[model samples]
Target: MPRPKSPRTRPTWRRRFALALKIFVGLGVLALIGLVIAVYVARAQLPSFDELKSSPNGQMIRVHAADGTVIVSLGPSYGEWLSFDQIPTVMRDAMVAVEDRRFRSHIGIDPIGLARSAKLAIERRGEGRRLQGASTITQQVARTIFLSNKYDVGRKAREAILALAMERKFSKDQILELYLNKVYFGGGAYGIDAASRRFFGHGAEALSLSEAAVVAGLVKAPSRYSPTADAEAAVGRAGVVIRLMQETGKITAAQAAAANPTGVALAPAPRQNSVRYFTDWALPQLETLIDETTRPLDVWTTLDLNMQRAADAAVRANAPKNAQGALVTIDRDGAIRAMVGGTDYVSSNYNRATQAVRQPGSAWKLFVYLAALEAGHKVEDKVVDAPITINGWSPRNASGANRGEMTLRTAFAYSVNTVAARLGQEVGFGTVADMARRFGITTPVDTRPAMVLGTSDVRLLDMTRAFASVANQGVAIIPYGITKVTAQGETIYAQAVDRSQVLVAPYVAQQMTDLLQTAVNTGTGRAAQIGRPVAGKTGTTSSNKDGWFVGFSSGLTTGVWMGRDDAKVVPGLQGGTAPARAFATFMKTAVANRPVEEFDTKVTLPEWALEPDEESYFGQPDNGVYVDADGNPIDQPAPPAEDSTDDGDRVAPPAPVPQSEQNPEQLDQDWIDRVLDRTPAPAPRPTPTPRPAAMSAPPRVPEQPSDRVLIRPQEARPTQ
Candidate 1:
């Protein structure tokens, strides 16, 4: 076998070169065939030219204030559809320089740029950096319109194919226009005009060089480079863009120096982004009111920008540190004028005004009192404030001391828990719950005696609506924000004129208003007083967890709530302290120019309520006389020893006397006769003394000088 070795021969250089060339050619041919197959697949999947060109831009919802001031734009906001000529030259040049310097010279994809990006990517890979992108503007347009942004090889191949197709079908100007109009800028902005408006409060045609640079810089990282998000970062990015513009000869060195981003003025968006809360609340209603939201629609909201500004200022200034606050303002017609969901929308977007459900505390008493009035109980009707136990649950006043007896008005104004509990029990908690539902409290109201003290939770908006019902003279109100929705200057939907539905009688509303007015005048809501007849109530939850003030004046209703987000106690918090003061602060400016209007003064009183009864006489105990259901003291023997047990710490409830036995009409006649000296009147009860210190009226708030004034204290109210 060894002897059979073949002769060794080396091929000439030409033969070896030919063999290498053949192998290279075969590989090239195979690559070309694979590329052809991929292109065919991608092309087959491509949309028609018309379909791609006519693709809709992002759905923009321009929310405007009642005065037509743009508050916010929800979804992906698009500005006016602009042609290439309408776009500013500086903006176009900046985009080209920063995004793709070879955009005009490239045929869909730039080989030079791709090779450079690959080199950089390879260099950065060792440093664990993100890969560089070399997508031309044409590629970006194609990706934005026809292909997904996934970073897979297949997606990139499709993107390249689409970009090539777009280049062939459209002019360079058209491609640029599409890119400028469809690019996603941070802050929910799409299109050059939208980005310009969002960042500079003007159209793209009005963008200055610096502003244009800022917009163009957002192409790399919209959120991180957004001027609204971080001005310094945006300015630095813009400086880079300016440098690129100068190097690309789109701008001169002097122009680049002059295009200082530091001097750029951004649009006047709220620093806290407070208006976003309102827009979030309103945007959902658009679907119900209109057929679809696929187009750019103009929403004429009921929000008053001035009021919104004031509300934001007040909440930010007054909300306690480490605590949150919410405020909502509505006109008499139920139009929500201002809403601050939390102290700052940036920190947390949980809408406390419309979404949070917390105990309303004594504010829930509004429904109980309204129920009593509807049940023929008068504000001046006497009710006992003695210690009471319903189902083993003992409710105590905020003061923790029982005020023996007082008029219904005084009890309500003072927020006497014992009196409210007794009234709820007598009037029936079912009726109280129904009354709350009538006033638009959508939250579940427990039909239990404890609910009379506001153990059930409710939203600030629901409580505000309940008060608005009373302010509307018993008419139920549905809070609304959108007044009209239009598209392309044609009205798509208008808020229909809803017929007013009376939830309570006019007289009942009037009577409830009187009680509320007294509460503001001297009771727990005194801090909420605005000089020209305001009516409202205050609510404080257990351990001072939640404080609330809901009031209405001058055809406007406003609600304020302060609390911790975790339902934990904010030590020393109270309804009249921070919440009431905030209400007054917001309302002072809220109703500054509105004409002073007084609540309806005509309230019909019950016959028995005309004369003062023992309980109504300065909240003093009765003179050993057992009162019947009519509150008229009857001549009866003293209660038995067992009835007076427990060391007299708890007063025995009045013995239930038959209503037929005590004729209220006859008693009224007898009172009239006694006044006329026709019959001997019972010896008048000894003049009752002033209320106890714990139950005494609050000190009068000093009067301010104006037709419509808020008597704000020089210093903030003490907590609790």
Candidate 2:
């Protein structure tokens, strides 16, 4: 009877058990829902690897200029990726030997490597060596693409799981390909091909066995082994790789010993984030050429590799021994052809061409005078070079000496610092600033009297672009590197020349061009003379902090800048010296095979206005025929009243001065005295001056001849 009673069911206990079962079922359903949601989210977040791989878009690439002369690159590129099939067997074998000894046999998991790594770690732990890591190639690739480098037990567990999953989904070869393409091998490069190029200056296929071993070693610790990071250590470590390859039987001992004694030459140059002058000129134009939001883009730019090399060489070839330099070139269509950011792109990536915002010094006079021309002031206008202040800022000439009253043309030609200051003020600071910006000046401009004297800081690229606008006859086509973009062979973008507006009057451009021509012919820019009709302007920063030569031929425009990376000024270097000379040398060689073209017909001046007085402002002057704004001849009825005044009192006959000496106006007698100091004791030839006359004939407009405009110097005579 007692046993029967004990067998009675315990309803409370049964109720608790049933409730626990219900709770488990509900929790399982909730977990299933959460997992479905997570799967969807993860899928949505992941980009299609196939699409990314197949597309050759959303990338910047090198292209040719009109003359087929330069190489220009832009953006954090995923371009020109070399395929696995294209890679050399030697390189692949080296990678396998150095990174994964059993890459082909273990289906990417490499169990044998794992066992060996565990044993080593255990053995080290026994001896307190603290060694670690057993990652295979597949694990490394997964970590690179989908995980961070942060170390932790949980992270290691996850990496192993993902690697196993990846092995299940992809073949060993596919995993290797992904790994090869996704890894960063230092030098701002991501992928074996780019790494190959960055480290060896050639394609992966061209790498030697030693080079391959070096690259393989980098896979373990890229930054530590980067030649730029530490050249001596990197090269030294390469020897270890060669030895390891031999020990592993991947390479014979003889082969290892026979490898290049130099090891891998991964010393291309330190990649720099400093401004790139040429790229600065070229990028804005590319923005207009593609629609990046909708799809990937591949831009085929206009770049001439040879010209780029030449420009770089010219800048570096003649740079001050203690200074660095930059050079940029663009075609007539506003396409960037070639760009060298610095004298040594490898040693320094600081691209002065785009980013060096130093004072333009006297080189800024070009814009000051151009603005004057646009403001209805003739190049022959006259202004006082005395100690006058503009907005409380007094500017001095380059020579720190000023000349009295002189024609604007002469002031500009001489680069009279004081005269330029006055003209800049007269042109209206706001107007000049706007004009300069419109013409492509990128740095912040100081709207003070000193601006006329080039007190405004500007990058080499901006200086070059502004000059390009002037050379393009006032139609500013912002320099563009990329010409067109495509996606999966589908044309997506095509860049056409888009000149927003005329920066200045066409006549003003021609006049400015003519004025620059005179500089190349006889003034400071004399060293920049070319066989063809070329035009450009030169600049020297204060204390010679920066030197520049920006010029353009009919089909191309180029600029060169030289200076120190740390803003250390060079001694005694002027825009007209090495900078101009380099420009001239490059231009001469570049145009040797091309026909010489003249600037569009020169503007005929009405003979009423004085000869271009721009020179007086910059302490320089031009000697063109005197004319008026109306292009008419001067009708003044004044003959040289013979004996009216002796040569001594002959108004001191406005003397010649350097562009740097036209400021802080000095007594006409003092200026003449200085000129005399520079001149020979007794000159057989007398300088000619235009006399006041009432000529009835209309100003003679040189016919638009089809001959090359010669740049020879002879009393400022016209080649036409």
Candidate 3:
């Protein structure tokens, strides 16, 4: 009786057991409900990812020139348009078997597969192996379309959600197609097609079972397992995939054993810049082509890529090994179609055409001739080439002394340094600087006394632009690379262009162009002649530190520059020697297929248009604009007269038609009376004071040249 009262232990135990059973049943019921809800939600949301791109406008684009020349590139992912039928059947089967065996049975979420994976994962913490990818093709496709390459439980959950949504909306075949097209295969390839072509030089549909396994294996880590990019790693991965296939019964052991010797045969990717020169000319003008996003825009220039290659080959063929060089070609309308900044892009990105500021040498003389014509000088004007001094800066002739009193034609033909300097000094340096600036030479120029001898540093691009202005009859058009840009056929940006304007008098420009043509034909630029009406000028910097040839054809304008990177000089190679030779080489080959045409025939030649060989071509035909036939002057000069003349022969330009005596006709008779009286011409009345300001720094004196210079003649060996 006492024991019974102390404890009804057995009865109490039964009650506690009943309570535990009830709690367990309640928890099971709740868990089952939650799982059903999760399954339904996953099935609902999984297929939405396949409807549209999660990242719209995420396109990697390439920058092209006006001539359809590729320059730079943008974007990260590469995708191809394809269908499921295009994929290798083996790839789909293997991925389905290993990644999601129950893929066909599940709606979107595979809970049974997940449960088995969880159980095995827990059981084999020590069973180390290569890799384990339980993601189905749908899940992988969803992740590729919407998610970043981040590893986390959240990422996995999100992948599953998207996969479910994707599977609901897209057929399994569609998901597979999207997966193959979106997966990266490394080595700059973006999709299965790209990867297949890159790795095997064939289509993805043509892949063998072994090849399919190798590619499928790369889905986990493209860069790490790319057969073409990394051989040893890919072989090891392919072996793992083959083993998995055998273990999973996708392939037999005998079949895998027969599929031996895994290797990747690599092929080099072709360049998009087949017309590099055309792209180069278009780059500076492409600023307007870019959207705020810095995306690359396509530009179809006038370049023929194959012909461009021939042109570039011609330039590089002559370039000295490892030497620096630049080339540019454009249409007469200032549409640049081709360019080569250097011999090789992998070596340097310094765009010589638009970046290198070097002495234009005789090329600068073309501008000087223009100035002389505008200053009333005819082509027949004579100038004494005797040794002359500009404030102790003695300007000498390229040829020996005393090309004495030669016509402006011979002086320009010979590229006499002294004559050019004298004309520049007489016409006003400010005028020259202003003319150049108006013609699109944005680079700063110190219009000093030295500039008279063509001592300013000029880029090949600017030089060519200036020549183009002349070719267009003073219509100075800024060269533009990009013409228009679009995304999926939607225009985002456009290149705004202004037509050419009359810079110099049309006749003046034509005269100058004719001079340049003669330069290519018979002057220092003779090497630039390409069996066509190619107008060009040769330039050699002081001491040969730089060489240049800038010219234009009816269909194209081209410029070439040659020098050393270290600023070292090269011997026996002037602009006419190497730079012009390079230009001619490119031009001859570039225009071989096109008909030979003359300079712009529309450019009217002025009555005063004198040949470049005319003598006594200094200081205008009869005082230029200062004294027209009626002796009517225009565009008066600035005043504040001081010393009318400077030391040496630098006489100040006519004083702004003395504000009080603005009429040149009134002073005309007075000027004639003084000449007739011959009172020793009263030492010639001086005009305004001469400004004594130096332009840029002194001209560089070359010590020698570089050996590895580019565009070297086959026999032209550069001295060490």
Candidate 4:
């Protein structure tokens, strides 16, 4: 009874087989219907064949130096388009051997190749091997031209459909031509012709067998195998391609051996790839200047290859090994002539000249002094360079001890911090910030009192542009690199000469220039002096984290910055030492052929500005003794004594000024001695005074030129 019941419930084996067959058939029909819908959808979304063929390949920006030398080619660069016949036979064979040996036999998709690739992938699973791709040359053409790089079932199906459609519409030769013209090779090169020129410096038709293998190897991973990126890796990859050529019977063993991938000669790279920094800075400007970027365009820039080479050499030679350096040189009209963002462009592409924001230190004083001049303060006006505390923040000069009283010119030349802080207060912080903005400082300016010493961060480019405004005789300058942009032999954009509005009065700029000129000639920036007239400011931040020298000479303004990327202190680093020296070395060569042009000298200087700063010449008048212009000690008349009081209400006599401290003038002399290669005689120091119990010590002075000096009668200079 149990056996009979089971048979009745389970039904016969034939009946069971028929039911399973029906279900399988139903599922197969559903799958076929879904595939049909997907094909229809994909076809609807695809572009017309003509539209795909006529579309621009990609955007390319070819930047040229002022002399028409190619500085850099950005984005996808395409060389002359080559027809199938124009391509070399070896190149065509190598590509086929490496990418798809069955390219000619497959009907857009190769089932056998896909099955082999799938089996290899399954065998290599968990072995840390890269998954194999089964894309044929036709499939690659379809994906590259008409589809995205998304790796998914939907994308694969669409790619397959597109490849089939292309095979139906175009001849095999036509498909190969499209594939060769649209594939991407590294270093921004597009198309076989471009790839050939990029790697071998020759057209596709002129490609050698080894070079052909090298170019063909780039098809798998362009960046990894790019000859310019890693020549050895590229050569090794080419060797693999050569082996494939031999295995596929595309070349005989002797032919492969003679190919000698290792002997392939790559094109020489640009003398200094650091030019990329300049091009990177200029590329963004194109977005705003032009309306379309789909077509290839030629950008004529203001960069001078000679100046750029000099700048690169100077930075490399002068920058400390433990730190980085950046330099920006612009014409008086704000044309960027040379830009070196770092010592090595390959290691890091961060454009410090245009992108990094760091404290400029004393260099920020340019704005403070300019505001004072515009506020009707004369360079001859006396300002006290003594200890000052504002809102609990005490600022000290580079010298620990203050030089009691000095002219504004003396304070500026010496870069006395106390004087700058007092001036910032007297002129109003808001006004100082406004002056900086007016002079083209685009970064935010802190209105705090300490900002007078350049606490706010700023870019080297902005600071250079601000100084260029002064060198341009108070005319505002907007730093620019591109001079013109052309596409298809037609001008798309051209720079206009529009630096008309003045940032400061000509007279104010003249006075500021006088101070800056003195700074370079005898002050903190003494190391930056070139034989010709030069005006510049040196900046060294706290802990020597950053050093900067920004100057202008012979109608060129250049700014140099040195520091570690991490903003860590570099021992013995000062703006006057490395940055200023770099500035001088670069300028000497940058302006060697240009005529020497002096700064404007229409504004007359005050008598004090022309005369020697006595406080600087002698140690700050110590105790009751003062030094004469002749450098002899002279006693001053004593003041009347105050009445004695036991209640502690009487004022205490001012503490005796320290005699061991070197004045600004003495610092200047020391710097001059170094520059002139003169060993200076050490000055005698007086006995140290006992410190008062309640008096706090001054901040330690940084090693720098902290004193001013007299412009010798023979070297008397007019206001510039």
Candidate 5:
């Protein structure tokens, strides 16, 4: 009752309360001023007007063929510029409806829209619903042109301030034009004009309602909404845009229902040229050519368009779905004229021609045969084509039948496994490996007997280059792709003139070429023969996993391989079938206009090896013969058992009998067979004297004078 009677009695407290309220209000006003000042200062540090106007148009690479024709364009391709009035009204309405429904009535910022968006975001979070964004058209223009796309409070504050500045400087139409002109629309398109041309192949002014909706939907995620990248996603996004347009009254419900995403027309994508394989190979070379640059690059290459077309057609027609074919054509000077890496580059960009490391199979016999010739083995030397095993592994002939007592030339033509293996042991394995490396084969070689039959893995590129050496008359040549690269109309790099060194002796190369010619003419590679003289080899792996034909005309070296990426066997396919046919198809077109040339067949055998002597063969023809360092025929021995048939169809030789029961001649013959079989020679025992009943026994063979010799003659003694 006392307080109610005199409320005014607390005047001092009332005055103090009033003064505190005024001070609080003053601090709030000062804080607001500081915030405004901070926002303006941050805006000043953003991208300058000149920097925004001079943004880089993405880099482009233009690859040209050897004939100076533009084969293809790589990288982002931007179209002509578009103006605000040139943009279709439907496109504008579509963007406005999807991006900002209240775009026309709002200022640079919309507090009500922000509040509504925030409330919905909170409700969605609690209800597990998708959130909605509240960026205005002005704000998007500001961010795309002058701000980073970060989403923290500082970025939001700066975005708001810059949007206000943009609104104050330009009208709504100008802000919209800026946004439409600078926003990305996927496939490296940066503006509405480029997007329209890339997607519709027309100007922006010609966009239809459905097309406009598609363009509008791409604003969310250009790559995801790009029709080329994902047509289904793009169509779904366009339907969403159409629904939003209907809800916003930009289009009637009937119109929205009538706009079918499937009915939307899109331009055909540009044809992807097979030459991309060459560009992929040549792109890395650009870094070495130009250290670094922002300018457009023009690369001049050695690719012949006609040859590329021929190679592509050949592979497409010949290669199976599960299998792929790779073809590389290199000139004698080492310039790559054509290269087809795979069947379809779009489906798979793997470059089989350059990157696949496959077992060369018998194609690798080129190196083996070359090594033998260099080590003093003649093409006409005799070798038995009987079944033979080395170190517990017996390699069977592909034909499943062996020819008996054939010359080395016949053995090579038939791809005889036993003869090749026997020859590998005669010529040191180390020598074969060295010869392969000397010819530019970087693959590691194992000296095991299986390696001689082509177990080592080698890249098709390396093999092609090695064969190019044979075509170049023993000069080793390194394959090259790009000729030169220019940047901004100035030459940045030019390839150096190729310098080749002799790796194989001319005589040896000629002999090898002769061997290969026989292979193509009458051997397993008969399918690879062209109208012009061709010399090459055919190779098939153990399980038919890889089929290959690597051959050369006098002017070009071409290699073709057919196989699965997973190393699975192609059913019933062999090197003489798909691979050889593809090579012939490509080469026939490849050398149409070139002059016909033959391989240089001149070769001279060492004087001592020119003729065969009585010592070359044993008394019987069924036994194997021997050759010395100078390729002279050394000696041969008769079969172990007197009943042993002269035919080469005999089984594995019986193990050596005990020396004590045999005459000196039988002991000598047994030791010689062990050496030929690569079995360890028996330990020396006291010589046995023959009885008068076995006077046919010959002189005892002596030990090899040097370990390097595969066979050495016995020392002669004067007869009593």
Candidate 6:
């Protein structure tokens, strides 16, 4: 009986063992089936070899100046596609040692490395640490070419399957070529070829062992290990790669030791062109002309590199220590030839020339004078420059003093603030704003006493365009930089040559030009005189926060602004100092060898049009709309209603009609009577009562020539 019991225990043990074996076999079978299904699915998702080869890779976009010189290159570009033979043995070995130690031995996926990594990853998960990646070079290529960068296990499985499939589809050399080309190096380069040329200024095959090691190290972290960006970090990374090469038997110990050079010979950084601002300004235009996924286009711009350099030098030499400077030069045809957005773009790239909006100060007087001229005011018209107030807001001269009455031209040349305010009021703020818009100043203009003094914030580029209209003899110029765009050698876009409309009457513009010339000759902008005929104005804000000199030569119009970004006052900074000197320095070089040309001195208005009138230029309507400070409409008493007749005939009043309600015929008769002495013009009607009060604070005093303390002439001129 005892023997029978012992035999039954052995059978029980065998039965238990059999059950465990069956469970293990079933799980094994299921895992095999799952792996086969995953492989099949991944295989179907993989892109075809030909399709992968032909996919759009990053390409270069070249920007050229007007003279066909390459100013800069912009791109997400692959330098030059290279075959396996084109890659040097040293570079290939360095990349293999650093990126994938068992690249050649593994069939795309390294099972040993993956298992070890998984073991460590499992342990790290328990410790709550990040898992390390164990992807081979082939797996990286597969992930780059055919898979999205997903981090889940399912994606890893797919990546492994695709990598295995790639191994079967292409030779090791082919896979290596693709890997080299697909990896990203720094500075917008995408491949070894581009990276080599970008960092070393040479082709991949020309890379030395040390250079190759540095280039290979960049594959791990392009920006961190860029030879051009971080020389120390790049050399340190190269040392690691060199050590790995020695450990992998790719190079002898002596060779590895010899390769440890003190420094890497990175290419010298390209000189920053003066037209960098132009490219930056044109980039948005380029984006609009071509789609994001479209091939790179050649952007031909109207940049004159020589002039750009000159402008850049002038800005750097003239800008104050605490201030930044901007300069822009436009041709007579509205072509932007040169633009220096800041003294040093590398230090700050805010593009002050095109992007910053600051008070124009006295430079804005141009529009006020033009508006007055358009309203039948002659340059010689007398304007009282005594202290003036509107709605309890008094505007004073910069010195807090004023000249008695002065001619409009003389007042303008001296930058008389009270007279400009008076002129703005006589012509109407709306009329001044309209004149600004017509001259291509698109920024919002506040209709205030100070607006005539340029209290409104306006872009430097817009101001340059506005002055260009005066230089161009009233033709409206829309400033532009891009000239043409080509893709695949086909013209995709070209700046259409549109005829500019007449913004100001030629005669009015001529008169304004003459006044500006007077300003440069002996007034506030005398610092801007360049020997040749020139016209310009100087502007300095109340606190000396903004200084400007905007002017034009016969061949070019240029504007310069000097200011601190934070709007802090720069001591001794005035438009006549730094900005005017910059304009003179830049214009001297810009107009070299060109004959000095004079402005057309002819005034376009008729003799009668030169006489002042009571009504505003655009005519005050009967709807009671008047502009307040800030350009908002203010309700004013409408002109007294005239008696209406139903007989379709109008009667001329015998008594002298009131100025506000007089018809055109009555005004003409009154003017003719005054001119011919037939009847003495009725004593001028009293100025209408002030409009509704709107201003909350006093108007700031505007800069004036008399107020300016001419320090030393050397203070105005910057050292070269």
Ten-residue region with minimum lDDT total, candidate 3: 643-652
Query: Candidate 3: where is the Cα deviation over 4 Å?
Result: 1-58, 62-74, 107-132, 201-210, 239-265, 270-287, 290-303, 490-497, 600-720
Q: Residues 448-510, candidate 2, lDDT per residue (tens digit)? A: 545565666777778778888888888886766666666646877776688667888898987
User: In candidate 1, how many Å is residue 511 off?
Assistant: 2.3
Candidate 3 is scored at a TM of: 0.74
RMSD of each: 13.0, 14.1, 14.8, 12.7, 15.0, 15.7
Per-model TM against the reference? 0.69, 0.59, 0.74, 0.68, 0.63, 0.70
Winning candidate number (TM-score) = 3
Clashes of 4: 5
Candidate 1 lDDT, 1-720, residue by residue in tens: 456544344457867898999999999999888866665665576666546544766666778899998777666766776788988898899999988889889988989989988899888897875546789999999888876767878778778877876776678998898888888888888788888887887888888898889999998999999888899999999999999999999989989877779999877874657888898899888768889556678899899988888898888776656789999998988899999999889889899999998878778899989989999998888888777777766655433446465788878766677788788998999999999988888898888567887777799998998898899899888899999999768899998646468899999999999988877764667667666778888877654567888899999999999888887555445676678778888999999999999778732222222222222222221122343322234476333321210001112222444878654443453665477344433654323333446654333234322211121222111111
Please, what are the lDDT tens digits per residue for candidate 6 over residues 1-720?
A: 455456556677788899999999998999888866766666676666556655545556888899998778777764666778988999899989998989999988888888888899888797875546589999888887767877888778778888877777678888898888777787888778878878888888788999899889987888998877778889999999999999999999889888954566778888765567888897687667666455656789999888998999999988878689999999988899899999888778789999988888788888899999989998888778787776555655543445476788778766766788788988899899888888878788887555777767889999999999888888888888888888757888889756558887899889899888877764567678787888988887655567899999867999999988888656556676678888999999999967889787621212222112212111121112343321124465324222111100111212454788654433264565577454443546333333223212123323333222212211110100
Candidate 5, residues 182-221: lDDT per residue as tens digits?
A: 7778887766777887899887888889889898999999
Model 4 per-residue lDDT tens digits across residues 1-720: 454466556657878798989999999999878766655666576566556655566887788999998777766765777888998888888899998888898888889988998889889887955436789888998889877888878888878887766666677888888788788887878788888878787788898889999999999999999888888999999999999989998889999889887787778875547898998888887889999768788999999989999999999887866789999998977799999999999889998898999888789999999999999998889889777777766765432456577888778776777788889999999999999988888888889777788877899999999999999889988888999999868899999968788888999999899888877765667678678889999887765567889999899999999988888655545676678878999999999999998777522222222112222221121112232322223464223232111100111222333667534333343565466355444533322233333222333333332111111222110011
Q: Quote model 1's TM-score.
A: 0.69
- Lowest lDDT block of 10, candidate 4: 643-652
- Per residue, candidate 3 scores C-alpha lDDT tens digits across 223-243 of 888776677888887787778
Superposed by TM-score, candidate 4 places the C-alpha of residue 172 at a distance from the truth, in angstroms, of 4.4
Is candidate 4 or 6 superior in TM-score? 6
User: Could you say which candidate leads in lDDT?
Assistant: 4
lDDT of each: 0.75, 0.61, 0.61, 0.76, 0.71, 0.74
Residue-level lDDT for 424 in candidate 1: 93
Candidate 3 Cα deviation (angstroms), residue 474: 1.9
